[model samples]
Target chain A: MKVLVPIKRAVDYNVRVRVKNDGSGVELNGVKMSVNPFDEIANEEALRLKEKGVVTEVVVATIGVAKAEDQLRSELARGADRAIHVVADQDIQPLQAARILKKLVEDEGIDLVLMGKQAIDDDANQTGQMLATLLGWPQATFASKVEIEGQTARVDREIDAGIETLEVDLPAVITADLRLNEPRFIKLPDIMKAKRKPLDKRELGDFDIDVPTLEVTETRPPSGREPGRMVKDVDELIATLKDKGLV
Target chain B: MSKILIVAETLSGELHPTTAKAVACAQAIGGDIHVAVFGSGDQGPAQAAAEIEGVTEVLYVQHDENNAARAATLAPQVVALAAEGYSHLLAANTTTGKDLMPRVAALLGVPQVTDIMAVHGPRDFDRPIYAGNAITRVQAPGDFVLVGTVRTASFGAAGGGNSAAVSDKAVDAELPSHTRLVEQKTGGGDRPDLQTASRVVSGGRALGSSENFDIIFKLADALGAGAGASRAAVDAGYVPNDMQVGQTGKIIAPDLYIACGISGAIQHLAGIKDAGTIVAINNDENAPIFEIADLGLVGDLFEVVPQLTEKLG
Candidate 1:
């Protein structure tokens, strides 16, 4: 079985993103970038499947500018067998990204596509589901636990109500939630080996997708909360709560 | 005028509160609003949807396989309905909406805007990014149908007054057979739902063990509040994932929120920023939770929680 993991380069989770002074968008200048945490978890799941001999190869793919190759190379070092970079000069919307991924899935003959539930940058949790619709494949999203057994994948999803177990046929898309798996650290030796692994590049025009449908008009920081006062003790806290009629 | 289509969400034959909130968002877009309800048999939820203010009609779609909340079966039906000259498609930014809306958008060959907190026009919306740290205003092309998910926390539920017409609609799309729901394990409790509760009490990793989490629950129960847990508590196995409140978890806006033993992480703070009044109780005086807390108390949770619970009782 061949597993494809779609990774994304996003603002580091810990960095405090600020809106531009001109209200254009979030400031990206000199901020740290890393693979989205959920995508890293997806790559980790694929690597585990490969290590267990259930998957023959694990391929990591990303759609971004030339700098995104660094993200793909990092995935390769972590355990992916190869990498595919779909070069796009500007940011592509989720639908276009899914369409391009659909084309790549067919071209690569991928048996399964695992990806992050959402990118922390845009917080748009749409790619995996959109890709599943475009390919007419079943999707098991927000997966906490995934098990592959003879053409079927049983996924336990963390939902609002509780855990929902779903079984989907092979050649499906699975989106990883936070609890899926802790990604492995890249070793120095593995990094050296990844430098020699196969890395393929393709252009966005190769897929013949529609133009983006959405455009960002502006961005601004959320209104700041008022500074709060500290109470000296539990009694003071209760008194403050009473004064505010919150108790 | 734009025609808005809202996908009604329900559980056990009753409309979810988020559905009404979605209607409020649709009303703000200044459209002739119609709601589509998909389920197996009961028409209770559809009838409820028809009564929401500003809704013009309710289209109830009944299918044999649509007994449960399966996005795979529902999205196709929604997509088929969306083809009937609807200019906009909307649903609540909830688990079900998140599961289904993207598929509907893809099938319609459009991009979806998720978690819209405000509507400036039919095509312009404001959504939070980076866990509510920044708000981005976006606009979709007017030529294509706009698809979006409403942030329920930001909107008030549409009131019930006049009843719109309800009509039965046929399901015209082929449903997928590969995805099957095996079983669902729901956390059983009588407490108010965390997302809609007026007051909430949350515990963190400082609770130490799952057994020790009873203190948090006792406090919540005494206060008649919902029980929530920080991601740290959920990750540490001190609570179930459904009880988690944070950016990656459920975003809640309650009137009162009590943070017990929670060292405020930014992600955790994002969930409760909309809460009216925040109270933090932690032994560490310098915990970041105090930075946003309206009332901060420095004390051991093991001692403070029990005392708080007793005082409330």
Candidate 2:
């Protein structure tokens, strides 16, 4: 079976994001960009499936500007066999992204699509579910474990209450959550080899889809909490709690 | 005036607290708010939803195949109801809401805004990005319906003095059958839920082992607070993932949060930033958690926790 993994270029998870002074969006000048952490986990899962001999090919796709190709190359160095880059100059919403991915799934005849549950930048957590709905396919979101048997895949998901397991047929969508697996580091030799891999480029207008329907009016830093004071000992701690009526 | 439809969330035939919080967000938008409750032979949640102060009407939809927890079956029903002249759709930013609302937005051919912290107007909202590091103000197009999920931690629950009418609404959409809930394994405990708990005490990897977590639980029990764990502790098998508090885990905003032995990674800080009062107790004074802590104690958790519990008792 062919496995398709959708990755995105986002701000490095460790960077403390600051809003632009103009209130347009987060400042991206000279900021370090990398594959979204959750999407990295998804790619790692797909590579593991390939190693287990369950998947015939692993293809990674991204929808962004030319800078996104750098992210695709990094995934290729990590283990993806090929890359598909859909060029978009402006930011696209989850609905448009899902529609574009749906077209790719049909065009590539993909049997499985693995992706992140949410991107750290937008935090929308919508693409996987939206694509599943548009395709009328089964979805196993926030998957912690996945096991394949014949045509059915058994997935364990991390939910608020506890773990819930579901069985979905082939041609399904699975969104990876944390704890799925720790992504492996790319070695220098692998990076050199990745430069020789195949990379395909497509345009956003190639697919017939509606434009994004949301607009950003402004952005600013969240209000900060007051600086806290230090207490001398346990006695002082109790006093502070009592003083605030928090005890 | 804009008409808003809220999808009510329920657990075990009872309305979840976030449902009322979603109502509070809708009320802020100044609209004729209606709530839709989908379940199987359970009118209790619908009745509970009607009692929320700002809710004008409650539409209870029942069917044999309707399981409110399953997004595949519920999204279609929500889409059908949204077509009846409702200009805005909202739900709590809980697991159910995060899973269901996006599908509704996709079916309606609109973009969804998730984790909305502030509603400035009918088409304007503020949502957190990069795990609450920044807030972005967004506006939806007036020509299309606006769909979003309210951040329950930021909004207080609507008051309960008013009574609204409840009506039965029929399901006309073709629900998807590709997904089904085989079994759910919920955590068995009598402790307060971490997400809505008024007070919480969380432990980190410094607790050593799963056996050492008892001290953390003991202190929480003494204070009648919920017990939480950092992602470091959960990944180390010191606790279950469900108890983890961080960007990938549950986001909580309790009245008081006590961090025991936690080094306070940025992701963990993101989860508790909304907390009213934060207290940090770690062996290392240089731990990042001290920066934001309202009260900092530079001591070993193993020694401080027992003494604190004794003092509280």
Specify the CAPRI tier of model 1. Answer: high
DockQ, per model, reads 0.80, 0.75
Identify the runs in model 1 with alpha carbons over 4 angstroms from their true place.
none
Q: Write the per-residue lDDT of candidate 1 for residues A1-247, one digit (tens) a residue.
A: 9889999999999899988999988898899999999999999999999888899999999999899888899999998999999999887889989989999999999999999999999999999999999899999999999999999999999888778999999889999999999999999999899999999999887987775578898889998778887777667777777788878
TM-score of chain A of each: 0.97, 0.98
Off by over 4 Å in 2: none
- Model 2 captures what fraction of native contacts? 0.72
Evaluate residue A127 in candidate 2 and report its C-alpha lDDT on the 0 to 100 scale. Answer: 97
Report the C-alpha displacement of residue A79, candidate 2, in angstroms: 1.4
Candidate 2 residue-wise lDDT, A85-116, digit = tens? 99998888888899999999999999999999
Provide the TM-score for each candidate, comma-separated: 0.97, 0.97
Deviation from native of the Cα of residue B258 in model 2, angstroms: 1.0
- CAPRI verdict on model 2? medium
Tens digit of per-residue lDDT, candidate 1, span B196-303: 788999999999999999999999999899999999999999889999998988888888999999999999999899888898999999999999887788889999
